[model samples]
Target chain A: MIGDAFTLVLLDPMINFLVILNNIFFGSFGLALIAFTVIIRLITFPLTRRQLHQSRAMQTVQPRMAEINKKYSDPKRRQEEMMKLYREAGVNPLGCLGPMLLQFPILIALFYAIRQTLPESPEALEALSAHLYQWTYIQHAVPINEFFLGIDLKLAPNEASSYLSPAWLFVVLVGATTWLQTKTTVTTVTDERARAQQQMMAYMMPIMFAFFALSFPTGVSLYWTINSLIQIGFNIVTYGLPALKIEPLLKSPAPAMAPALAARSAQPQSVAQPAPEPRTPNGPGRSKRQNRRRRPE
Target chain B: MNNPRFFAVGLLLALFVVTSAACGKIRQPEGWASPAVSDSTAYFFADKDRFVAVDLDSAKAVADPKSTTGATLQPLLWQFPSNDQKDQDAYSFKAVYTQPVRDGDTFFMASYDGGLYRINAPDGRGERIATQADIKGKIVAGPAVAGEYLVFGTTEGHLYVVNKNNGQLPVGWGKTGKDLGKGIWAPPLVRNDTIIVATMAGEVRAFGLDGAEQWQKRFTASGAVADLALLGGDSIFVPTLDRKVYILDAATGAQKGKEFVAEDWVWSTPAFAGGVAYFGDFSGKVYALDITTMETKWKPYDAGHRVKATPVLIDGVLVLADRGPVVHFIDAANGTGLNAVPVVNAGTVRAGLTAAGGKAYIATTKGRLFVADPVKRSVVEVGVGGGK
Candidate 1:
């Protein structure tokens, strides 16, 4: 029953929309997939933006979280303090998961939609007719041209007969863009152990998705590559290009570190000391240090 | 894994695995090869990879083990590409779609993987005659045997004419095969010296056995033609995906009359007997049209589900199976339900129904076979190798 409802609610709509898009894109299923990715990304933009904002806020509170971890040895006390710190920073740890969760259904449905729209076999094509709406336009568009930019969209990279086939190019793009998307994402981990794990994930995720692209149809790989590219753009916009020393285009609404840094600086000290500034790894501060060293006396 | 970042990544990976599993095996072909019965043994695809020969007499005598009476089914007579041959790369057919075409003592079958084999009926011993390299694409259309030549079309739009004796291209035919430029999903109809080939692009062309074009102009339908039938000796019945069946001149690719519009897409080739053509549409409505006037013989019989299998006339009763997997028996003379309650199968029936010895044989997508007695209005699941 759940499967039927899923087909009726999500898969059917997605398949129909894809068929319509394929028609609009001049029967190029590849172009339709790219366009579908863009549209899905746009529809879920608000949730994605909120997730990015939460990630940014988490990054700003990392120092306080680290301090709390050090001061409170008891696990309970540390967890309590951590929750307090999160509340103060206006960060919801689970907020980052909202968009990810939303994407799962869409991804699954899109997989089925791609398979149905660009059927590889005659039986698959006949099976497709049952899902189609009675729309004459959609009906005529089918037995869809599976070729897109010289690649058979129904074929996976592993299914490619030769190493030189264009399908392998999608595999490469899926890996490269996934790595870039992960690398460009702002890190929120303060603990050394967690930070190491996060860093490892930044590498592992790309490899994992790249491996999956081998088994997935080239159309799906194309979607992943395009989605990852869009996400990289989103990451750049939200977290900025740290390597290029650019500030985030959209600043965090709360600026969670400012009050904490100011309060710490106001505390009286026996000896003169520099006020603690929130560490922005590979951010403007690192560029400032580099600029200072480059200056001539 | 203790870290929240790790947890998130782990969850994402878990979801990927679950979704992939839920989506089922990617590119797995579901074989719906119809049964080809010769004498007491029925030859059909038992699975995507297993082609078995079942004894019809044993199948009828075997009681349903699932029933309270407790009688087990018998083992199959034989199966092609035996356990030993399955491991050999050359013997793999992958997925058989074409019904095994019997020519005397040997049966010919083609697979979706583009391999063709000639299997002897007695022992089920088979040898690959054509490989994927020779066909260049998947074979969905069944091969038609014409004297010494066996003709079949591929999904890549190439029509192959190989010698039936050996899998070699005939000497007079094109070296690489004639490129139709569109995928052929329907089996080519062989009539006299000409071969009628219908493509997925909805174009119907006639060609001679020597690979020469026999038609001055090709008849093009609005939708893809899935199956074709010979109305008489001179006319062809073309069932198309556009919900219209057109009668074309068999000698020349010309329309004989206006197309008969159906309630839905017509995929099944019309079963002809007497002066009427019997068929069904995707909408579950069985149709009977007079070949002479191209008019309806009676009100369309409602089968209550999608009908993909071509109906077979058994003892003057029209036996049809629907996507419902429900077998309906209709009176051939006038379109009326012959069976009060239809016998439902365990899976969807896509293969064309086969009639022999006054009974109808059905092979479902789930690999289950059924033998229906038209006279008794009863259907029995034919278990194979002690299993249903």
Candidate 2:
């Protein structure tokens, strides 16, 4: 487990790089953090791509889902038929959340690692500063000069770094990058409601992350910002590559049964779906039970 | 696992190494060393690494004695914990061995690594008393307990008055936690209302009880002092690294008398007896100075090696253990060697005589606390001391 490809591909090399950067850059731990973000994004690229693919699949099946909802308008019937439709399409509704769950520990470990780059207490950090074996380009990384333009990367707000002396530049930069990343991911939308929801998240989540980043060390913010840019680049390459299959959005036809026709055309239609796996009515009431079974929602 | 634990362990370990090294030698590198006792426990440096206390009545730590101290002495009771934090990272700093001094129930001492500790007098149960005040210098002089205050000089030429009960501590500053001086290595002596302290810079200062300077004086041959003892009728007798002792008037800060011409430095605080003083030098020679004539007394020292322990004047008998096998007993009135008896084991002695009840309590570098009837030469209670 310790020497697996996932560990090597994800954690170890990055940690080594972080330690190296931390040593040479005595005056600042920010670079070490940025390096960590880049490493994490690189490692998680495949998963991010998979999630994006799943999202596109969900979008392609939307019309069929709408037809199923219309056929079983009753709540209980709709739920059942939805499950059947999902099974036929071979899509797990929550499969897209896998990447986020996998990245939790990485996020935590990175947070803790960079926090050590610049620590509080002049005494406690002395050893760590002296132990700087990487980042030799910087003259002195001990004080991690100006917190990359205002953040006192050593303090944790409750201690020394406070809102009074907030690192505004770093905070704003982090917020901007985060906003950009969120926008790129959730912008593949057709409906105004989904777009509005995406807009709210794009603004809210970035602001939240930025607020937390300001109170913490700049090393962490540096990680988040640089990581966001890397992810944004990756996302643009993956999602922005394909142009729109257009002419559909240009003419908004107000046909009353347009949704019905779209749904009818979207499905594999009649026989292609619903496999003929088995048909055995051997029990005394087997035929009656099969007939009474709830339809797929 | 957490920040504070790691920080504390680091601090404690530093204190330990310093206390062990300083306490190890049973004397400071530059001056004299002594240990003070209050409640059956003796507090002194095992070496520079840690401040240690052994139940003077116990024979436990003395068994299977080992000299792993990296210095001279190494035993658990003689073993020290570690040191705390420092300003400039002292990559090469080591604790200067120091003896402990007492005031009431508290024992005060400093680790060469930068920790002025106030441990319980009886059990050495790390009480939160303040003896440390953060000043950038080596503390070789043990702290002199004055009432509720402690007076000591640092490697830098500054004297400090620490709070009675850790009003400001850990960082080794005043109650408000501020740097006050160059820091002391020698413990201070309390006389009436004044505290007499000395530094390695050869500057001595008399500070009032309120931490204000009363007077400051400089000595020509400034180096390091081993011990400071107040002479009778208001005079301070100081032993120096320059192989001499200077007697100064307590009131006017005037040099009154000077005697003793040892080949090496005389650092231990000499024992005073019927108008005479008995001391030892680092080269292992004990000398006695006549208090009246300021001349050499009849016998310099009764032992064969250096006298590290400060002699205690008991019923005209100057009783002490030093660098040799036997505890020397001299006539305080005449400088005559009365008797020299063998102790528990062969380890060097770390502390002096603290006479309590009818027995003499002695702590050795072997970590054995002995409660012996000076006349019997037999062990009292084996493994019966405190400060675990």
Candidate 3:
């Protein structure tokens, strides 16, 4: 019963859409995957935007958050104050993860879709017949072309041809795009400890995804690369180019260490106010004149 | 952002990723069909592009020099595309999964490219009898050479009947003519002027030579029919993907008895002997059933791996090869192991065992052929030949 519902709700639609895309795009599965990623990202843009807004909101309230941490000597009161602060700012702490959580079902369905479209075994093909709808367009598209751009989409990027194959380019793209997406999505926290943890995740998640891309089928890696690129594009539109800049990452905790240096050189107030919401510069609080001055930085 | 709900969503995403990876299915690779042995030669798919003809006499002569190489002994014999042609990439050029069938002096086989070739058995000379343009889809099943015409089904759910001599389709024998409405993975069983073809949609249909439908049987709950075996001169034993064997009457397409349920799918062709049918399932258990009564003859034989190969009988011993690197020999009468321990050295025998001239030939996925004698309890490996 669960299988039937899953097929009806997610797998069937994904498979049909992919097949139709393949048919429209001259049977190039690679191109079809890119088109599908674009469609999925477009459909999920609102959810992703909500998550981005929450992350930017969290950044906007970081100063008040740090002030609460400093004022409340008691840990319990600090926690209560933080929740109250979030409520006043109209930010849901869980909103940043809601879009990611919703993406799981779609990701899994796409995995099954790629496997079903390019089944490697005779038994798999036979089993796939049942999942496919009774349509002539789909029936004629059986035994889909696994080759695109000289890579067997059914095999891993490394396994497709050999070393330095076209799949390698996909591996690199998946890594680069995933890194950029992660960079943009992560809120720049004012707390040094929390920022360190978020920065670690930003780098670690991309490397892990890239490793999987090197191991999974090229078709799957193509999906990841395209999906990541779409997310990165979405992030750039929402957060702008500075959030995507690798220079901040290369500075090695310079933003995190800035306040400490300022506390020693000047006042603690000057230290807390310098890095005010880098992710959302054009928002209501940060004036256009101030944004122009910060643009050169 | 770090809260119970945030961590809860992350946990769910991680759980889904692990679950998806764990539940990912691995299918049987294409082109693992067993070899067909004629009187003097053993024909098998060496790869997709090359269907090799191993001279049995030549192979035996090398093992025992006292044995003579007959007129058919041409060591490497003949392969498709000849020796000079650069073998096309298997991805671009469809590979041959169908076992080669010998009809008179010619060997007939179909490829993934939907081309049927009629090669002169003795020499390597052959011609492309049918192309994908003629059939309109890939040919997953081998050709069933019945009389002067050759019939085969395609992945496009269309059946094509063409002249074995010319490769041209007979008038009205394609998608426009008659189709099974689903892909046909197994070769059609031609008997009594009727072509019996099973579809991946869990359907069995028969068609006349004139491209007319005769009868159809549908198993709504059952999966695709993987293979068919004839029993009691009239009953058709169907091994299906739904893990059940359905016995149907050949003449009228009626159910003969209750389905024989298995632990998993019965994907391999079942072997019959002494009023009993022996087959294995994807779950690695072999079974013997009384064809007349639909009852188990003995306890299921366990091979501990997927048995996709059709079990063969040689000298009262049932040889069952598996998807792994082992082959088990059991006594056909009681389903007892004939040898103390099964031969665990054959190396991934996905193709079924071929028995001929008092010897059983087993082809491994590693491209090595092991010729075993059930009587002597000996197996000898043959050298690679035909194509590189």
Best by lDDT: 1
Could you tell me which residue pairs clash in candidate 1? none
Provide the overall lDDT of each model, using Cα atoms, as 2-decimal numbers.
0.79, 0.53, 0.70
By DockQ rank, best first, the candidates go 1, 3, 2
Candidate 2 docks with a DockQ of 0.01
lDDT of 3 by residue, B1-388 (tens): 2333444455456566656766776664556667878877777765656667777675444333433532222366666566654354322334666667788888787877666677787776776664323575567766888777888887757777877886556655753335667777778888888888887777888888887777755443256675776676687888876677888888878887788888776777778877788998877889998877889999998888777888788778888777765667788888997652344554577677888888778877655677777776666666553332
- How do the candidates rank by TM-score, highest first? 1, 3, 2
DockQ of 3: 0.16
Candidate 3 Cα deviation (angstroms), residue B160: 1.3
> Which digits, one per residue and each the tens of the lDDT, describe model 2 over residues B1-388?
0112222332343344334323421222321234445444455444434455555444334542333432122133533332332223422234434556666665556655445666555444553343345555455555666666665555444556666675444223364322333334456777776777765434566667775666656443344454577877577787765556777778767777655566555556766756677776655566678766788766566477655567666666667676664577766666677777776453666455566655566666554455546455443323422223
True lDDT of residue B110, candidate 1: 82
Q: Regarding DockQ, does 1 or 3 come out ahead?
A: 1
Instruction: Summarize candidate 1's per-residue lDDT along A1-297 as a digit string, tens digits.
Output: 988998899989999998889879887788899899999899999988888877777777776677665445446756877786776566887777776677677767777777787787767777787788877777666577788989999888888999999999988898899789878887766676677877777777777777777877788888888888898898888889979998888765754544754465356542222333344453322345554666798
Q: Best candidate, DockQ-wise?
A: 1
lDDT of 2 by residue, A1-297 (tens): 733553346444444466556555553456556555665666877776666556555555666665554344345656876676555555555656656555455554454444444433212222232233333332122223335555555454434434565655667878899777765553334434445655666676667666665555555566666877876675565446234422222122222323434455566667333332243453321344344653464
The native-contact fractions of the candidates, in order shown, are 0.09, 0.00, 0.29
Which 10 consecutive positions of candidate 1 chain B have the poorest summed lDDT? B1-10
Looking at candidate 3, what is the lDDT of residue B228?
A: 71
